[model samples]
Target: MPTARAIDTSDRHPIRAFLDLRWGGPTIMLDGRAIDAAALPGFVALDADGAIAGLITLLDDALQSEIVTLDAVQAQAGLGTHLLELAAERARALGLGRLLTRTTNDNLDALRFYQLRGFRLHRLAAGAIDLEREADPAIPLLGRHGIPLHDEISLIRVLGAD
Candidate 1:
């Protein structure tokens, strides 16, 4: 298997191209506002063949840190976990003290995954996707398991402690 390494986005263009392909853009929506994932720092995992296997984008606002996106090309390989851990580690390094993320209510897999990684359910932002879609129509109306992509489930992980 090919090893995964952090992507060097310092060069900018290549990373942007890759991100644009995976996500609609470097910009993402959170709590009714538009935020650019490429504008901030993130971690991308390169597979053994030097292909993009997984990535996690982040945003640090005045209140807390948010994981904009997390994707793995291959599943059940600990790729998601590794990327998440790296994002959390970076948050702690920045003295943020906590890492937060949001997933659609339809995404049961994401809910389970984040909880398994020590993130607690924070809140549910009902109809949040409506606002998000206004800015970006690409936000699918329905997601996996036939669930309607509507509400936003907030999850948080505390840092700087055992």
Candidate 2:
């Protein structure tokens, strides 16, 4: 299993490269805005070879911690879960009340992954992605399993009383 660690300033270059390769550059569209995910504080899981295996970037506000991005180089290997666990621990330490994330309607895998790990449906922003596409035309019309990517689904996991 890979070990997860906090992302520090020294990690910027590699993180930026990783995000660019996987996410089409470090800027990710969230809640109708473009966010520089590489600039966010989060966790990175490294394999035995010292290569990044997975990563999760967080955006925290006074009320909650938002998972801006989560990616695992190898699926079903528990890397994603480990990264999420670390994020939750950080959120709890910061006195955040919940962990939030958003996924496209076409991303059935993310919907299942988040829910199975205690996240619940928060809202369905219908046609959210379509509006996002207006700003960034590169946003694909179809996503995983060939589903039409139109809506944005928000999910939240409320932290237990600390």
Candidate 3:
């Protein structure tokens, strides 16, 4: 129902909102934290009507990229996959070896989504979720699907088609 398009410069606010929504809420990024305005080169996928639907952010260093947040109002649509392909293209163009991302143990859908797209298990931040709670007690202990959020699972996909 929606087609993907590049994110516009004026769309920065919505992109930030997507990050905040995914991260639980607007709060300071702990440690080496970077968001839209701070993230030097980012991409977003717009729906047919030109609304922000999904986004991917890549740190300038180019070694890694964060999905940041990707949401498709219509589940049956292929918007997510399109955004992912765009991200991969950008990563390849940047000559990055691979792209890395993290999702909570409770995000079963994300686990499947990334895995299905060729991302593989790399590492699990054993206490990152707890550290997050320490930073923001308001961060939900439970995930969108009601599963208890415990740890962050790191996943990676080599940028080269090899």
Candidate 4:
């Protein structure tokens, strides 16, 4: 498994390149607007050869944070978990108090993944992705498990309690 660490703005250019290429721009469209992901705080997991294997992007406010995106280039080797751990650690260090994120309803894997890591299903926005697709037409009509990608599900994890 690769080691995960915080990356600052000085590292934006390369991280932007990786993230933009993954989704076709330096922005991730959510709820009908573009989020400049490169500007957010992030963590990168690098392999033995120093190649990036995973990434997590986060946006924080005075009291909490939102995990904008999380990705693992390789599967089933614990890269995603490492990145998630780093995000949670950083959030605690910052005293953010909570961490939350949203995923499309069809993403059963993401739903299971976050729940297993202590995130709880917090909100449901029915048919929200349809509006999201209106703003960013690149969204596919279907997603994992052949489910229609129409709703948004928010999941949250509260920190600093123990």
Q: For residues 1-162, what per-residue lDDT tens digits would candidate 2 score against the true structure?
A: 898899999888899999999989999888767899999999998889888899999999999999999999999999899899899999999999899999999999999999999999999999998998998899899999999989999999999852
lDDT for each residue of candidate 4 in 123-161, tens digit (9 for 90 to 100): 999989998887768889998899989999999998865
Q: Summing lDDT over every window of 10 consecutive residues in candidate 1, give the lowest-scoring window.
A: 1-10
Estimate every model's Cα lDDT from 0 to 1: 0.78, 0.93, 0.68, 0.84
> What is the descending lDDT order?
2, 4, 1, 3
CA lDDT, candidate 1, residue 133 = 79
Q: Which of candidates 1 and 2 reaches a greater TM-score?
A: 2
lDDT of 3 by residue, 1-162 (tens): 455555666766776676566654433342336354424355666766776666555554647665555556556477677777877887787777787777889988889998999999999887678787886687788876898876889888888774
Q: How are the candidates ranked when ordered by TM-score, highest leading?
A: 2, 4, 1, 3
Per-prediction tally of clashes: 2, 0, 0, 0
* C-alpha positional error of residue 97 in candidate 4 after TM-score superposition, expressed in Å: 1.1
State the TM-score for model 2.
Answer: 0.97
Misplaced by over 4 Å in model 4 are none
| Worst ten in a row by lDDT for model 3 | 25-34
Best by TM-score: 2
lDDT of 3 at 98: 80
Q: Distance (Å) between predicted and true CA of 131, model 1?
A: 2.7
**Alpha-carbon runs more than 4 Å astray in model 1:** 1-7
TM-score per model over all chains: 0.85, 0.97, 0.81, 0.91
